[model samples]
Target: MKRLTIAPDERRHIERLVDDVLAEHGHWDPVQFVTQAKTVAESLPLRVRQFFRQIQSEESDVAVLSGLPLSPDLDATPTGWDMAQKTGAGRREEVVLALCSAALGEPFAWGNQQDGRIVHDVCPTPGMERSETSGSSTAPLSLHTEDAFHQCRCDYVALFCLRNPERVGTTVVRADRLDLPAPLSGILAEKRFRHRPDQSHVGPHGHSADVADLDAIMFGPPGSCYLRIDFDDTFAADEDDHAARDAIKELYRHMCDAVERVVLEPGDAIFLDNYRVVHGRDPFEPRYDGKDRWLKRVNLIRDIRRVFLSTGVRSRVIS
Candidate 1:
């Protein structure tokens, strides 16, 4: 894991950058802002820009940037993402995330998730407490690769914490931390596993027949493996494939043993390399009294052409 805390001067400099963008734009339009974000990010503090550059070149598994600016009069947490969206809560922070995310990669969105918003609101929503989506509070989100079912899945999942009064921890497991035996690793390297879209993409009652894809659990150069698996939705392609099923179970056990928890405070943003780290959240009781944990999430890819090639369009949103 790698982390860089913003210095006092750097924080104020970032505040000025965000203010300038907001003053020029009347309203928050991430779709429009995304195109210019990378160019604007060049104006960020030199130290901050260098930090992100190093992470990109080194392929850091998990990285966190702390002490970004937050509104002094930030609004109370909304009941759900829809409420946050309708109220335009935390617009400034969203801009902050966009600027910083653009430094790392091109920010994108999923058409079927979070209403196709480039930035997504993650908070506890009533009636979804035990569900599998980001709205869940009591149910612990299982550690998994973000958008594992898609070939064009993001390269990084950027999560900026706006409020976490309870200090709920985000669980993470790095691919390098697992100590799998050769037999299990060999099985995982084969293309015998099927990944289904998570509930966030396909609602609780929605079917996964349309988005299931078969791929390897682990792939890449020897001694350095990349991982892609959603424990809750991934399964063996053939129900009779007992070896693949057992390999999945064994991998889960290894991940459980190597799990690490990161508790993010306000003004902190974490970028999880989607291929090298699987991340989830710890279950917490929701107060819903305008103080529930809230975060802004953005999916980023190393290049924008990946999205264009996959969607056959030049837009950032994958439809």
Candidate 2:
């Protein structure tokens, strides 16, 4: 896997973007900041465009980028539009929003987490179950795509740490580092694996048991490849797709041994090319005694048309 380190000059550029955003609207209302950031990003320069393109290409395989200034008021979770108005780090949202907007050429929203229900499909546990008791144990999460069931996958998924776990909740990312054998490659190329959405979320309404083409190669771009995987062992496909599914399972099993794990500390933010890498977390005992592990997450869809905004699908703000 190729490593892309953030050069001092590039880091300075990121800092400048953050500073500019905060300086202009740090004191504004959260709603107003969101609106202004959108306006500013729409007219970003060509150099910024090139910078993001470079980031996408170079960091396709490397999953972690360290060394960014931590906001002094970083909290356990991000304050929503309403809550942000009353917090010291309210401006931090604007700063992060601006940085991601410049980096991905698309606007982003704060992931809403209300009463332990996070909006995005984050695994509270490996089993996808919320803690039955206030004192339940946390398991090590396996590497998988953020949302494999969605038709329009986010171009990038980022997690910014507000607090680290007491024990071990190290993030593990696997890329092309795990080599797939010929048999597995042939099975995947044949496109035989099928995946169904976990029944938990789909059961409330009339969601169907839609199965994904698991054998399909996760990445599509020319220069580099990304991955989208479902780590739950219970996710099974049809009999005909069994061989291909087995091949994928075998590859993933190998990945368990080949992962380059990193334990993220406070203020660390990890951005993953959602299309290229599979990420997971090591299990840790969450001491629910007020200091449980907490990280703020954001998902972004890169504008394929940053260089040509009128060509692709128009960006929409998810409410």
Which candidate has the top score in lDDT?
1
Q: Write the per-residue lDDT of candidate 1 for residues 1-319, one digit (tens) a residue.
A: 8999999999999999999999988887999999999999999999889989999988899999999999999988988888878999999999999999999999998887877899999999999999889999999999889988888899999999999999999999999898889999999999999888888888654336645577899998876679999999889999999999999999999999999999999999999999999999999999999878999999999989999998798989887
Cα-lDDT of candidate 2: 0.50
lDDT measured at residue 311 in model 1 versus the true structure, 0 to 100: 76
TM-score each candidate: 0.97, 0.68
Q: Could you give candidate 2's per-residue lDDT for residues 138-216 as a string of tens digits?
A: 6456566655544444667666555565634544555657577767755555545444443332433412444544445
Among residues 3 or more apart in sequence or in different chains, the pairs in candidate 1 whose N, CA or C atoms overlap within 3 Å are none
**Candidate 2 residue pairs that clash:** 140-283, 226-275, 226-276, 227-276
- Cα deviation of 127, candidate 2, in Å: 12
Q: CA lDDT of each candidate?
A: 0.92, 0.50
